[model samples]
Target: MDTLTNIRTFLTVVRAGSFSAAARTLDTVPSVITKRVDQLEHQLKVSLFTRTTRKLDLTEVGERYYPRFMTIIREIDDAFQDVTSSRHRIEEKLRIKCPTTMAIQYYGHILTDFQRSYPGIRLELLLIDRSVNPVEESFDIAIGALPTSYANVEDIPLCPLPRIIVASPTYLQEKGMPKHPSDLIHHDCLTFLAAGNRWQFQGDKGPVSVDVTARVSVNDSHVLMHAVENHLGIAIVASHIAEPSLRQGLATEILSHYPVPDLWVKALVPRNRRGNAAVEAVISWLKNASQPAPPWEQIPLSKITRQAPS
Candidate 1:
């Protein structure tokens, strides 16, 4: 990126005949222009311009390289404009990134739907817990659970990620049930402490955050779920996650009055390439994929019953 910026700077300075004039055009300081031109000269092993006390003149080498630089710059501009113009055109790679849990939980069907929607476009999905730069990594889009505020990245909420208080039927039966969020104090709350403990929620009275104490702490949701099923404690998890048990009557929803914050899944795209068609298609697809909420059977990932990988 700096290299490209430097090239443009050098070309501008040469065309303008002085660092001051170039700075005026580029809206940067004179020193910045000087460093960029100097760096560009050093990179090409030839001084691009001869600087004097009052006037600056392009060297013979500078004159020769100017056309080449302009040609390259023009090609880049044309290519970019062409790509931008083809916003509705199809038949290209649709690469996307997502968090592991989100990919399995939601996008499992979204991907299939995208493939079906755009058969000419090849879908490349990269799943990771850590967020990756879409532009830097050549990813077209991202579906992630965590929120980020990085430059050149923008987020659009895909769905509400409501966390729920879930404990397996066996566990709830043996240990009893929590009637309110505050009642978690008496239960063996099996939960992850990494994301924070104060589960803020909304009740009939308004919003409230309850500080929880966990008798059993586990990092992985899969493991924590086992502890929950075994009646080890109450586990607070996203609705999609506890869906299997909740629907099967294996797990029950607690504190329904104090609504959990909507845990949201977001689609992140390169800030610089927001309007690209390939990216736009996937973003639209992701938001619209689950027309009527998908059936759990359509997704094969284990929810509460997942032990160790088979």
Candidate 2:
């Protein structure tokens, strides 16, 4: 067995958690992945993985050896890059992870423009709704809003995304507008699970928090927006997600005088991989794309002429 190739295959299987998934990632068959793992275990004289019908788990030796193998692989790739990177103009493949909603709503053009500018670079974008750990997943960079800080990753802030409270004109008319945060209890609320059940706002005196009773709670902003459009309830969502509705007059802003917490869209890269050329290039593009005014705030609500859906 070729030791380096087998090691890489083994690492992929470990991270992917299944032979078939690893095979798809590696562009090979499951038999090939299985053979590589078998060969590796044979050579090492230890069972690396404990396989069952449901899932594959790493054994004691495999757990210890996994990090060591990863470090060696990274070092080898770095050495190869150090030798050939200077001769080329970013002729490398970049694996990027982003939220599905953001990719569809905002990042499509930015990514396409980058690809056009750098023809030599190949981009693989993975759109996932859940949180991702870039280092564990072996992705070059992960782009999304993070709730809190991560010690293992470096966060590069790109833009601010303010959370806003919005309701359809019909709903507000039927339920009456909330004069204060305390008034929210009397209204139907649609909540985003990513933002906790409690909603926070900055009032004239200080901060005001409301423990809301949700009519419906969903993880996807698109779904929540649809509910708001139908006059089901008021929703608190990131400004970007609510921009189209708000601009079209499908939804009207509530609590206009109060301030909501702002969430920033940031690039999260492993601390050790921050200086990689391809990663830095993408980050630079994102920063430039959001400058002066972020995409979410580019068009004022008053400028939108399209009528809201009935």
Best by TM-score: 2
Residue 145 alpha-carbon offset, candidate 2, angstroms: 2.4
TM-score, every prediction = 0.56, 0.63
- Measured with C-alpha atoms, the lDDT of residue 304 in candidate 1 is 26
The residue ranges of model 1 lying beyond 4 angstroms of the native Cα positions read 1-95, 116-122, 130-139, 147-151, 169-176, 192-194, 214-224, 291-310
Overall local distance difference test of candidate 2:
0.84
Candidate 2 accuracy as TM-score: 0.63
Mark the 10 consecutive residues where model 2 has the least summed lDDT: 301-310
lDDT of 1 by residue, 91-181 (tens): 7886788766666656865687677766667888877766566767777787766545467788877766657877877777777777888
**Candidate 2: where is the Cα deviation over 4 Å?**
1-88, 240-244, 297-310
> Per-prediction count of colliding residue pairs?
3, 0
